[model samples]
Every structure is written in C-alpha cells, then in structure tokens.
Target: MFRSIITGSGAYIPTEIQSNPDFFTQPFYSNGLLLPSSSHDIVSKFKQITGIEQRRYVSQDLTAGDIGAIAARNAISDSGINPEEIDQLIVAHNFGNVAAGAIQSKAVPSLASSIKHQLGIRNPACVAYDVLFGCPGWLQGIIQADAFFKAGIANKALVIGTETLSRVSDRYDRDSMIFSDGAGAVVLEYKDTVSTDRGILSASVQTHALEENGYISMGSSDFPDSDPQVQYIKMKGRKVYEYALLNVPAAMKDCLDKSGVPIQNLKKIFIHQANEKMDEAIVQRFYQLYDLPAPVDIMPMSIHWLGNSSVATIPTLIDLVKQGQMPEHKLEEGDVILLASVGAGMNINAVCYRY
Candidate 1:
C-alpha cells in the first residue's frame, strides 16, 4: 500500500482584526434602516453568546482566491519541492468571490492559472479542480489527494481551503460575528514506507444533507418582481449544536477503529475549532463513551480568538504546530493523532495519522 505524507503546510490571515466591541459600536444601518434602541443590548448578548473575541477580514478588493494563492505559494516554498513536481491542485471552498455558478465557469480556472504563472510551473500533466463541501472541504480534499497519490497518478498535490465569509455575512445579524476570512494550504507527497516516518493511516467522512438543521440564507424578495441576493449564511444554532455533539465523537471512533488504534493511545486530537462550548461538550462526551480519561493533552483551541475560518481550521492547527504554540507531547514513531471535523451541511469527517 502507498503512503501519503504531508510534506508542508501554510496559512494566511489578513492583518485586520475586528473585535466584537468594534463591530457592535460601529454605526451601520441594515436594509437602509437604523437599529432600534435595543441595539446595545443585542450587541452585548451576542458577544456573550458566541464567545468570539475577534476575527480577520481581507480588504474589500481581495478575493478568496487571492488569499488561497498566497497560502499555496508559501506551502510550495516550504515543502522544498519545485512547483513542477505538483501534479494536481485542489481548491476547497465554501464561498467564492463571484457567484456560486460563476465559480464553476471562471473562478477556479483563473486561480489555477495565476498560481501556475506565479510559480513558473509548466506541467501539462497537472490537473486543477475545485470542491465544495461546506466546512469539511479541506478534509475531503486531503482524502482526494491520498487516493491520487496511492494510485501513482500524482507525485505531489496542493490542497487549499479558503473562505471570505465576510462578503456573505449579514451585517445586522449577530450570527455573522462568528465567521471570518482566511485561507490555508497543505502539500501532500507520495512517499515510500522506507523514506517516511509519518503518513495517513485511515479516513472516514459522512454527510447528512437531507436534514434541514443548518443551511445558508436565501435572500428575501420584497417586491413582486425583483432579483434577490441569495448569498448570506443562515443557521439554526440549537439544531447544529445537537447534531455536532452526537455525530463528531462517533466519527472519531470510526477512524480509530479503522486504524486499529485505541482512543487512549492517541497523543493528540485536533478537532474542528467550531466553538469553545461545543468543543468542551464533545470532549466530555468522548471521554464518557470511550471509558478513558479525557484527552487533556489536546491543544487549547484557537477558534474563540480566530472565529470560525471554515475549512482553514485544520491547516491553521498545523500552522500553530509549526509556530511551536501546540504543546509538545511524547508522540512515539508509530503513535497516532486524530483529526476530526464537523461542519455546515451537517458534515462530519475524521482521519488517523501516525507520527
């Protein structure tokens, strides 16, 4: 069997950080109407509810592809691999700068061309594609890269997840505060077992799309004949909470089972940084279900401060590891670490990696 190894990883966030106080204090009208006298109270309540200290958004001129391209370039440079070695590029995104339909026609191809031009890569054998899987897009991209590598169809692949959620945010809705803009990328390479010490062991992904628990917002039509802007994000917080609490732990268990590693033996567990409260609840339930001590060795979450960066969360964790913020655990050569994520579209994914 072939081993797919992560050769390099990178992430990029805009320099601007918008704290809750700044957001709420700004004088902004929604739908051409001023907020009522209750605006202050609503802002305070929202801040307490989401627990998001701040989030980053790119300048108005920047697009999701721009941020993703920057991160991809960094990952390629860091991997010490020439761009010509990359046989494929996969961009996993939830929101594109253009209309969703426009992306299928133009956006991804433009991004691929720009990256290839900037890197001076001239590989006619390379293929580029885009994927949309809500928040679990990056994980799904990794699984795709693994398959291509195992088939000997590719020697290297670049997988990127980038989102400019701010563009689709409902300015008046408090829920928009939980999302931000960012991009992250990973370079995957095929490696012989004799040459690599770390590689993917197993992966599992599932989606519950028929359920209407959480979904994007379709704009309202006020007049009899008007084009509605169906671009904003809408969600049912309570229902999403319940679904995540139940499904994420089960997904982790499945990955562990497939990899033949006991839950207690995992040195680290990097879950999707959805929210602090949800993270705590999932950790507690996992301990109860597995009959082991809670995995206290897990990294302190970066989501509360960063907000939800959609698919960038996992590569952001990998970036944290590179920055030395992730705690050092005694991970042996063959020990396993679990990466699990639950996202919008009610998707859940888990993967096992040996380090």
Candidate 2:
C-alpha cells in the first residue's frame, strides 16, 4: 500500500509586526465611529485575553498569492525537487489573492493556479486546485494529498495555506486584533511501505453549517451606499468561543480514537491558533475525556507571537517546530503528532500522524 510522508515544510511571515501596544498608539474606529477607550487598558486586556504579543502583516506592496508562492518555492526547495516533478498543487485560502490594503478580494483563476504559474511548472497533467474549509483548509489539503497518494493518482503534491486576512479585517472591530497575513506549505510524497504504523493514521472533518451562520462572515451586502466597511471579516466572538470550546475537544478526541492513537501518545497537538484561552480550554477538555491531566507542553502554540493566520496557523506552527525555531517543541523519528482546526463554516477537523 502507498503511504504519504511529508518531505518538507516552509512558511513565509510578513516583515511588519502589529503589537498590542500599537493599537494604543492609533485611533480605533468601529461602525464608522471612533472607539472610546484608553490604549493602555485596551492593550492590557488584549494581552490578557488573547495572549498575543504581536502578529505579522503584509506591507502595502504584497498580495496573498505573493507570499503563498514564496512559501511554495521554499517548500519545493527544501524537498530538493524540480517544479516539474510536482503532480499537484493545492492552496487553501479564504479571500483569495487580495492586495495588502484592499477591502475586497478577487478570486479569478484561483490562488492555486497563480501559484503554479508563479513556480513556472510546465506539466499540464499536474492538477492545481483550492480548498475552502475555513481554518482547517491546510489540514484538509494535506488530507486530500494523502487520498490522491493512496489512490495511485499522484506521487508528489504540494499543500499550502496562505491568507492576507488583514486585507479583509475590519479594523473597527475587535476581531481585527486577532488577524494577520502569512502562508505555510508542505510537500507530500507517496512512499512504498509495508509499515502500517507510520504516516497519516486518520483524519476527521465535520461542518456545522446551521450553527455557523452569522458566527463568521465575509464581504458586504449589495445595497448601494452600504458602508464600504461592510465588506470585511466579521465574527460573533463570544458565540465562536463557546461553540469551539464545546465541540472542538470532542472532534479531536474522536479523531485520535479513529486513528488508533491514544491521546497520551501525542508528542504535540498543533491546533488552529485562533485564541489562547479557547485553545487551552479545548486541549484541557481533550485530556479530561481520557481521564488524564493536560500536560504542560502537549500543545505547542505560536499564536502568542504570531496571532491568528486562519488556515496558515497549524502548518506554520509545524514548520517552525520542525526547524527548531520553536525550541520548546521538537520532533524525533517515530514521533506522533495531532493537527486540528476550527473556523468559519463552523468547521472542525483533526489529522493524526506519526513522523
């Protein structure tokens, strides 16, 4: 049987960093109205609640596809493979390719096509497509690559999650503080192996569309003179938090069970870096389900410094840990890892694997 193994990983974070204190230095507008709050208090509260010290944002010169291509190139380079050798390219993104400061995004041709073009791949048989599963898009892309590998349809695939969420963020809203711009990528290759104990063990994905309406939305209405500001990322923060806390743990536990991976065997649980507190609560509850206390380092998080990059979160975190950029998190041969995410479709997914 064919099993998929990650051959390489890469990430691209914009140079500009937005810190909590920066909010205090600038005026915040909400619903076209200036917010009335002290900067120090706001910063303190933001740090306390979100635990984000800062996040990176693309400068006025970059587009979503630019960073994504850069990440793809890096992963390809790391894999030491020629661009023409790739059998497929999959990009996961929300707003497509938007300029740094643009309010509206354009999706024509798809970011996957743009990335393939940017890489100068000449193979017409090499398929390219985009996945839109919210923050779980990257993980879902990985899952799709594995499916293709197992089906004898592809030998090598590149999966990427890239977003310029800052372009779609409403600075007037509090959720604005949680978003940034970035991309992450991985190269997966089919490996002939008799070992059933390695590679992707299982993946579980579910969507709760009924509960997601209004929980998270993008773009504005068609009415004339509708505040142009309406075309920005919006979220019912409290509802999302509660929904995630209630559902994500169960989804993760079920994924681990399906993968035949005991919860305690995980070397690290890489989850969507949406919220520090919410992620903690979810992990804690995951342990509670198994009647075990949560380990201090079971979950490796980059959100405290990187903010939430949606689909880019888990892949980027994995790249950083594997590269030793995240010193506290390390992966050895035969190590087990769990990747999971939740976001806009009210979607939740988990992937279990051994590396």
Candidate 3:
C-alpha cells in the first residue's frame, strides 16, 4: 500500500510582537458603541478567556504570500528533496494575500502559484492551487494531497497554511486581541510501504453551514463613525465557542475510531490554537467519549504566546514542536498523534498519524 508521510515541516512566526498592554490605550467598541469598560478590564477578560498575552504581527512590508513562501522554502529545504520533484503544491489561507495596511485581498494569481514562483521551482508538471477551508484549510490540503497520492497522480506534495489576520482585524473590536499572523508548511511524499502503521492513517471532516455560516463573517468596523464600506473580520464569539465545543470533540473521536487506535496509545493532539479554554474543553469531552480522563500534557498549546492565526495555527504548532523549539512537547519515533481544527464554515477535521 502507498501511504502519505510528512517528511519536513516549517513555520514563520511574524517578527513584530503585540502584547496585551499594547492595547491599553486603544478604544474598543461593540455594535457601533464605544465600550464603557476600561481597556484594562477588557484586556484582562480577554487574556483570561483566550489565554493570549501576546501575538505576532507581520511587518508592515510583508504580505501573507511572502511569509507563506518563506515557510515553504524552509520546508522544501528541510525535506532535502529537489523542488522540481514536487508534483503538487497547495496553499491554505483565509483572506488571501492581504497587503499590509490594506483592507482588500488579492487572489488572482493564486497564493500557491505566487509561492511556487518565489520558491523558483521550474517544473511545469508541478501543479499549484489554493484551499480556503477556513482555519481547517491546511489540514484539508493535506487530506487532498493524501487522496492524490492514493490515486497515483502525485508522489510528492507541499502543503502550507498561512494567514495575516491582523491585516483584516478591526482594531476597535475586542476580538482583535485574538488575531495574529503566521505561516506553516509541510512536505509529504507517498511511500510504497509494507506497513500501514506509519504515515497518515485515517481522517474525518465536517462542515455545519446552515445557521453556522455567519458565525465568522466580515462586517464593517464596530466603531461608530467608521467607514461602512470597509469590511473587517467579525466573529460571534459565543456562537463559535458553543459550536466548536459541541462538534469538534465528536469529529475527533470519529477520526480516532476510524484509525483503529486505542485511546491509551494516542500520544498527542495538535489542535487548532483558537481559544485556550475552548480547546481544553473540547479535548476533555473527547476523552470522555472514550470513558477515560484526558491525559496530562496530551495536548501541546501555543496560543499563550502565538494568539489565533486562523489557518496557520495547527501546521505552525506542529512545526514548532517538531523542531524541538517547544521544550515541554516533543514528537519521537513510534509516537501516535492527532491533528484537529475548527473554524469559519464551522468546519471541523482531524487526522490520525503514526510517527
């Protein structure tokens, strides 16, 4: 059987840091009304709920595609494979290449094509495309690459998730504190192996779009007197929390079951860095589905310092831990892990893999 195996990973965390204290002087608003609460109180509540003390922002000179290409270059180098050998290149993003200080995003060239050009790969056989599946987009790209491998159409693929949420965030909205910018990439190759235990094993994905479609939509700034023509990322915080808490756990359990792996053998979970509390709650419920207590440190978290970078979260987290930059978390041979994410589209997906 042929299996898709991840051979290399890389992440580009923005260089500019925005700490919570940085927002103390900025006025926040809700429903076109200035919030009466002091900035200190609002920031305190935000930190408590999201556990984000700081987040990275792209430099004023960079765009999403630039950073995505940086991460992709690193991943290709890490894989030690010639770029010409790659049969597919997929880039996952939410807002496309939103230039710094701009509200509009451009997708005409396709972020994947841009990144491929930046990487200087000359093979015309290398197909490049983009996937916009909300924050689960990167995983969706990986899933798609795995399908291509199974169909014998592709042997090597490069998958990336990159986003510049800060570029589209409404500074007047308190949810702005939850946004960040980053890029992550991974190289996957199909191997004809006698054993199915290694590489990607099973996966599950779900999207609840009926009433959930508007949970994370774009709207004019919440600040009164702001231009209504300009749109910024708007989210129904409570609705998203409730929806993710309700559905993500079940989807994760379903994927794990499909992998035929026991709960006791699951080593780690690299879940999307959305909200710290919501992620913990979802993991707890997932364990409960197996009638077991959620194990200590079973999940490695980066939201405390990275904030939520939408599509970039999971892949970045995996790259960080894989590179040994995260001291408390590590991935060793024979380790079994699950990658899961939920976001706009109310999309949910999970992948079971053996290292």
RMSD for each of the candidates? 3.9, 2.5, 0.9
- Tens-digit lDDT track of model 2 for 256-345: 999886776788899999989989999999889999989999889899889999988887998899889989888997888888899989
> Candidate 1, which segments miss by more than 4 Å at Cα?
26-41, 98-114, 194-197, 213-217, 220-227, 325-335
TM-score of each: 0.87, 0.94, 0.99
Better of 1 and 3 by TM-score: 3
Clashing pairs in 2: none
Pairs that collide, model 3: none
Better of 2 and 3 by lDDT: 3
Q: Note the residue pairs that clash in candidate 1.
A: none
lDDT of each: 0.74, 0.86, 0.94
Off by over 4 Å in 3: none
Give the local distance difference test score of model 2: 0.86
Best by TM-score: 3
The worst-scoring run of ten residues by lDDT in candidate 3 lies at: 192-201
| Candidate 2 residue 54 C-alpha distance from true site, Å | 0.4
Q: Tell me the number of clashing residue pairs for each predicted model.
A: 0, 0, 0
